[model samples]
Target: MFQDPGVGVFQAWDYVVFAALFVISSGIGVFFAIKERTKNTSKEFLVGGKQMTCVPVALSLTASFMSAVTVLGTPSDVYRFGGSFIIFSIAYTMMVTLTAELFLPIFYRSGITSTYEYLELRFSKAVRMAATLIYIVQTILYTGVVVYAPALALNQVTGFNLWGSIFATGIVCTFYCTLGGLKAVVWSDVFQMVVMLMGFFTVLIQGTIKNGGPVAVWKAAQEGSRLNVFDFDPDPLRRHTFWTISIGGTFTWLGIYGVNQSTIQRCISCKSEKQAKLALYLNLLGLLVILVCAVFSGLVMYTFYAKCDPWTAGFVSAPDQIMAYFVMDILGHMPGLPGLFVACAFSGTLSTVAASINALATVTYEDFIKYWFKNLSERAGTWISKGLCIVFGVACTTMAVAASYMGGIVQAALSIHGMCGGPMLGLFSLGILFPWTNWKGAAGGLLAGITLSFWAGIGGFVYPAPASKMMPLHLNTSGCELRNSSDILTTLAPTMAPERPALADSWYSMSYLYYSAVGWLATVIAGLVITFLTGPTRGGDIKPVLIRPVCNLLCFWSEEYRKACWCGVEHDAADMDLSGDYISTDILAMRREEPTEISKKDGKDSGDDLPGHIAEDRSYTNAGFTKDTDL
Candidate 1:
């Protein structure tokens, strides 16, 4: 009963449903903008006045990174690479737990806006600015892919102009994000999350019914060799092995959930640290829910195309388009259902793009612009934040147009993360975990890590693995009704092979999944070497609050030994003063110490012992600055 779609497939009701997504998203932004019009300071604009509850923040956290890449690419990946891609679920669990235990505590205690500000506190201004630039580049490139992926799919199925879709999605996202700030972004994310899930479920339920049932789908996958989940081969060159995905994938996602500013901004916006932790754990559950839906959707696609394989039949030009084609072919008769799927992809686009744009604006204002204009007004800063959102939104939308020429949506996005993330993750890890690493080490390590990642990632792109090495699991076009005998043979024929290169010469042949791991290791190793050569930072020079102890695993050691192992910095009882959840005891003690004690301890005037920046910025008593001077 299925027929190929030669033109646009969306019905009148389908357009209505699709249009409603933007309307609702824009409305949420307007509501928040109006509500907070009286007091839309920089703090309120950036972090919702730090009074947000856990639920919206949690949903926003999950929705921030769960863009069209996951919705469209995950299914396409599983269908082509087998169910081994599901191993990423393990990676997901690892990243969330590690982030919760190790990273969140320090972030909540600091109460900072820009995540990169911690870089300055731990290292120096140069390192902080370097990290900020890297984040900006990584986010812009990734947002491009996020916007482009859904637009490409829409173009394929509905004959929508690709650029029009990109601008429409981008403009709507920019409108809401610029109008309402973080509150609008978070609430819109919550609303969009619902729409996205509904769309995914519509495709899954309808597609499963058309394919018979779960058992039949599984059987089809098994026959097609698409159920290869437990591939334990230890070869690094093999594409989708369990170790590569689980281990390398852990570092890849850790770069996102652990230290990336997009999720960090949402997490720290909550009213308290406890609320922030709750949001992270809840985000884990949301991630697993979306993961299951995406993986199952891939399986359903495999069931329908088990014998025909849409790509080889020339029904679709790319693997990414297969999901869109399946939606139109299967759900086309149902009118608004196909529109729901489109809405799903667009919801993902809006949430992710909006989050990235907001976070970018935050870092630009807090890290770069604020220092330049010390006398900038609160009202001016708020307007600047909105203006920055518009600027980033337009820039990202333009990049989306450029991202169209790239290959395989999932791989491209993850590779970008791995290449940039590994270095950024390495920089943060060096600063937080090892107190001995000085500014030289931090700067050198970041540079080296990025160099290696790009060399490998770019090399891999230029000289891709040979067809024999990178070939997909057996896909057949034997059942395609439109294909004649000759056509089928041509579709299935093997092309002439290029001469095989030597293993030593083919470093780029390493699985793309391991790019993050490679970059991370390069950074750590290079960093330690540079630190030792440049004379490691003394324990006295580092702050205890900035260092996270890695000695939790030393249960067999004595308490004193564990304490000594942690940054080797001595902490007196008076070092930490906790007011509410934000800890700044040591900082306050320095400022409030008796004049005689200050003279005795540092041989300097009272308050002169504090760092110049800290003393100059009087509002920096709590974490970095007080409410009166946060901007």
Candidate 2:
């Protein structure tokens, strides 16, 4: 029973919700930008002075990763297919473990601001440059996808112009990110995450109440076979098989959160390594909770429209617009709900793009610019960094126009992530796990990785295939126009049944779920094999804990892991450099000596060492300015 949709258009209350968000976000940026204007250093501008708390940082991580693609796309997946997407919990679990146990200790112990800077230390500058460029491209594409997804949905719901929405979002996101830098981005994320949660919860709860309840929603979804989650099929060609999704998701997440700059930037900003770990763990929990809400919303959506489904009944244009249609269908008459829904969707968009812009600017400045512009002043550098943020933000907005041509929001976004993520992650993996993978090997592997990744990612899009429709849980023709068979919901085919071409490559039809893993393996295998062919660099600049193998497996343990992986690097109490969870009298002694060292150097302690997790604050010093710069 899809009613007149114009009734759900933006009311004054709706405009107020969006207006308040812009005012608050820009205000925070201005406040922070002005407050830290005195610092005038890339460190402070990029990394929040490295004194962030666990909670805000955790919430920021939550907000940064949950793009509008997830906000809108996940529910669409659930409503269309079933509960299989919930398996992402498995992926997140693996991601949390891999990130915390392996990747976190590596990056945190290195005391890095940019994740790829580790590449330069571990391999060569070429490898670092390669990774940075890949990341920049990926973030640019992803920011567009993030912006485009919700803008499209909102346009469908409220009749707002899509291009206008995109540009407006770009302008607002660029303004705050350019002005406030990381602190502004994090604080705004904390606030927007609250809005996102409230909006999602409201929709799910309201939709559930209107459609009967949770139990009814569940029963309705299950009856249609849309509730199937555990498909252990080993077929590589199938779309959502368990092996493909789980391992692929794990690798995908590892690529995104483990080695990527955006997540690592947040992790490093924490007060200490332990606090960073806390943020990562809390982010995992937050993702689990949010994903549950999204899946439930999908169930309610399916049940509500099981019989007189709007899409089948000619009430909607595209599958991606289904959630927006549901918003109007159930919550339209409510004065502020429709606007809140739009606000909620765009909140995800803004948080994601804002974080990417800030982080991208940071990486560009640190990894790409700092060494090149040796004589750049702190003031000049700050402005340039801000300029980069604005430039990337605008570029991202421009790309959103192209992303509208992609299929579904979630898949399109994930496809972009995997294409770059797999190769980037592979480069890092080769650095840590394989000592012989020198710059030659890394460069070769990177190229091969990207080639194969793009092939796997884009090939399916190019090859036209007929979709195999699946039977829905329920369908009714009672309220449908019944003008044609295509408008019938239950009669729609599943995604697996694509129309075959004369030369349809089953290989190209490999599931997107397997993309990250496939691309990762492609790069690593190519790099490893090519490493030996290139006469292997032998021994590496990587830290011991980075390549420290799993010593003592199944009671067959030993202390010889030192000679196992990267060679000559042994695990000692000194390995605490790799893990902050360790404490000792010597570490305590070193900590006690730090302030004394600072006091003696600055004479009267000019307060260079600000408290929490204090280290030598590398400020304008890197840009040819001495530590004793005149204020």
Q: What lDDT does each candidate get?
A: 0.82, 0.76
How accurate locally is residue 592 in candidate 1, as Cα lDDT from 0 to 100?
56
- The weakest ten consecutive residues by lDDT in model 1 span 611-620
Segments in model 2 whose C-alpha atoms lie over 4 Å from true places = 1-7, 464-466, 469-478, 482-503, 540-556, 561-566, 570-631
Best by TM-score: 1
Q: Whole-model lDDT, candidate 1?
A: 0.82
| Candidate 1 Cα errors over 4 Å, as ranges | 1-8, 483-505, 573-631
Per-prediction TM-score to the true structure, in the order listed:
0.91, 0.87
> lDDT of model 1 at residue 107?
66
Across 1-631, the per-residue lDDT of candidate 2 in tens digits comes to 3434343666778778767777888898899988988888878889887778789998888888887887888888888778888899999989987887778866765556888877776777778887888899999988888998888887877778989999989999999998888999999999889888988988998998997888888888888677888889787776676776788888888899999898999887766677788889999998898888888888888888777666666677667888988887777788787777778888888899999998899899988787688667778988999899988988999999889888888888888888889888888888766766767888888899899888878887777332431223344547546546654544465555556565455756777766788778888888988888877764433344335333323223433443453354433445343322222222233344443443344464332342212234532122111122111
| Native-to-model Cα distance after best TM-score fit, residue 620 in candidate 2, in Å | 17
Per-residue lDDT over 472-528 for candidate 1, one digit per residue giving the tens place of the 0 to 100 score: 787777787654567658766987755545642368887888889888988888997
How many residue pairs in model 2 have overlapping backbones?
Answer: 15
Cα displacement (Å) at residue 554, model 2? 8.4
